[model samples]
Target: MNTINTHYRLSHQIQDEAFILSQAAKCNLYLSISQKSIRLAVMDTERNKFVVLEDYELITVFTPMQVAEQLRLIAQENPLLQEQKWNTIRLAISNIHFTLVPETLYDPAHQHDYLRLHSDLNPLQDVVLAYRHNSLEAINIFSLDASTYQALEALFPERQLQFVHQTSTLIRSVLHLAPRTNLRSMYVFVERNYVTLLVVGPSGLEFCNIFHYLSPEDFIYYIIFVMQEQKMNPEQETIMVWGDITHDSSLFNILQKYIRQIKLGKKPSDLEYSYKFHDMFEHRYFELYSLHLCE
Candidate 1:
């Protein structure tokens, strides 16, 4: 039994009428697809803000083929998706197969070797290899599951979909919204069974990685261990967290006990949104919203 969580047309309710395709403004589509969920959002180019947003979860396990079919069907019937020319389309993958390497030493020709070292996937698994130039020094190289990549490709063929590590978007969100942060701080993005930790220091991205967890205990342990290992002073260092979590939740409680400064992340200061997004968590879609700002 697959479980789907949906909140549709929050924007249309605020805008009075639907964002019809005939409107001359260009729009963008952002998708955050993972092993367990698919999130889609639309941002009106003229308005420089998102207008339509939706997400779905799979309670039951499915093969990659099943999900690709589901996403295809959703696009076929979506009205906001009808005729607008998309300026940019982005997909962020949460798979652990991704690894970051130094840009100066990276060979555009050797992506396969780097990807294989980090992921156990067969080199010939019909996967598409790609990397995002994350920063002046860091680049994320990873594998996109063949079926999922092709499904997204077939859905929107007019413009090529830009892919990046899910954590990469988290980095983009922080840099855009909170560049002037604590001298040494950490950003935590929590999902159902996964966690992404990003450490930013004065220089640049200090550390970034994704980890899977089974319980709240396991979750806080990893966060604390990383901070300790980094020699971050719990008294002075801050941790800004977002996504699928709550302040009263066990995860938050555990984190608060160990870290002196724990706060929730906010929407990127660079973008605006309709009042429709007011009811939504300010941090829920940071990655999707930041995708528009991704180069």
Candidate 2:
């Protein structure tokens, strides 16, 4: 049997942190961090082997001593093999911010507060939580203009406050995925009832238009008009869709008649086949389309 050694590096320390760093032997690790948990993986350098070793949760009362003890136990249980050597445990701390709902009063029903906080574009909104990712810690807050801050303050006059700017790598990744110009157009029809227009290319994906309650003719016209605006020929392009629309008679027939080529998106195997509820239409369509294109 062959043995491999891996090291773990931690930074952005906070009271509550979630992150993962894997592939340590060759000095590269896959890092994933969020407010609620952290995950890390260690990969074998010689054989392209890897395993996740850290997936831990942090709490408000957690202390450095407690964390050190936890790491010690992990090292003992997963003792380094002879051929594989582990050394120089690296750690850092950082803070992460999560949105809080005053109305919910820390109840389970408000569990989605963190997701909503990250999604809100309003700067005045404030959240409480100093999540440590690695070795750095700071209070997470919303940076808002004076007017927005005043408006939000009025809404929750007596609530405790902490503010931190949004600066998570995950957030940055999402921003990078925003649409760039390469492909002319992308369209998603959901179960024949709704339509979403996406502008896609090398840059990424962007939402152009979302249409519901429109007739199939009008929707087609709208898409064609958009293509013209973007200086592209509609006849040369393709439209993609996903969802359960097996029973929609009129919409299905219209799609067959007017669209040059329609495709359904499939989930990428690399993505673990997990679908976001809000992204079901776009992801499914894109996945299916990608599968067919690759073939």
Candidate 3:
């Protein structure tokens, strides 16, 4: 197997040592070896606004072309990125990571099935850590299990893949390894086997949660429990729900009551990124969380 080392430097020394300890225990946390730099940006389709994040620093405005140009420059500098020849790359623009697959891919009626490989911070682990820190800043890494991995290969002989990272610290590190305004807080949620990611900052937060076997009720219960444990008032926080579960008006209504504000988090213009290079996914989820959260 091939491995890539990416490092990030932050302006602010994470002051919550207890929180860091908690995260390390729950999620497998490790320091990166290579201090690589990258730039990321996202567009708020509804507000007609653009937000660019570099090395944890935030840039007020950026066009789609500008984002593309930045990626091109990174690819030029990094040999591995240049090898991918990817049309686009997906980035969190915040300090979190998630997996995004076409909605159609999950349809049971669909005959083809292919496994998508993702590398980023682990969500379950990150949530545990973030809760301990009393901060939403976190990252996520995703990959398929052995059984699912094999099943996907049988379903789709041809691979349908995209590489993206949605971690807050990693995104900031990529920008310049220094803190920035655009890169804000991030949260991770998972249900069934799929991962849902949420990122918030000056431009407002976006949410995307997906699950196959778990019901929306279960997902909400977890959210409520986590918030309660962390002493977070859900009633004061804005929440946006997405995916098949949100289709149910009844469920959506219930969520709206519990959350400060609720909306469906989807923006077409937000789809832009350099789809190459996988992230590290070797650490244990619980270990990472415990190390980052628990004192």
User: By TM-score, who's the top model here?
Assistant: 1
lDDT of 2 by residue, 1-295 (tens): 5232222343222211221233233522322222223333333334333322334443331433333333443344532211122212211112222432333234444444544555443334333333222211222222233432343233335533222222322222222343455565565534233454555555433334445436868766766676677666656777655443432556667766776776654333233221222333443322121211110
- What lDDT does the true structure give each of the candidates? 0.73, 0.37, 0.32
Predicted structure 1, TM vs. truth: 0.88
Model 1 lDDT tens row, 98-165: 88888887887888787777777765554645655555466777777777778877776776668877
lDDT of 1: 0.73
Listed in order, each prediction's TM-score against the native is 0.88, 0.32, 0.31
Higher-ranked by lDDT: 1 or 2 = 1
The TM-score, computed over Cα atoms with residue i paired to residue i, of candidate 3 is 0.31
* Better lDDT candidate (2, 3): 2
Model 1 misses residue 55 by how many Å? 1.3
Model 2 lDDT-worst window of ten: 286-295
lDDT (tens digit, per residue) of candidate 3 on 31-133: 1101122332322223322222222211321332233333433444533232222222222222222343333333423211212243333333222111111
How are the candidates ranked when ordered by lDDT, highest leading?
1, 2, 3
Off by over 4 Å in 2: 1-182, 191-193, 273-295
How many angstroms is residue 1 displaced in model 1 relative to the true structure, after the best TM-score fit? Answer: 20
Best by lDDT: 1
**Cα RMSD (Å) per model?**
3.8, 17.4, 19.2
TM-score of 2: 0.32
> Which regions of candidate 3 deviate over 4 angstroms?
1-142, 145-216, 268-295
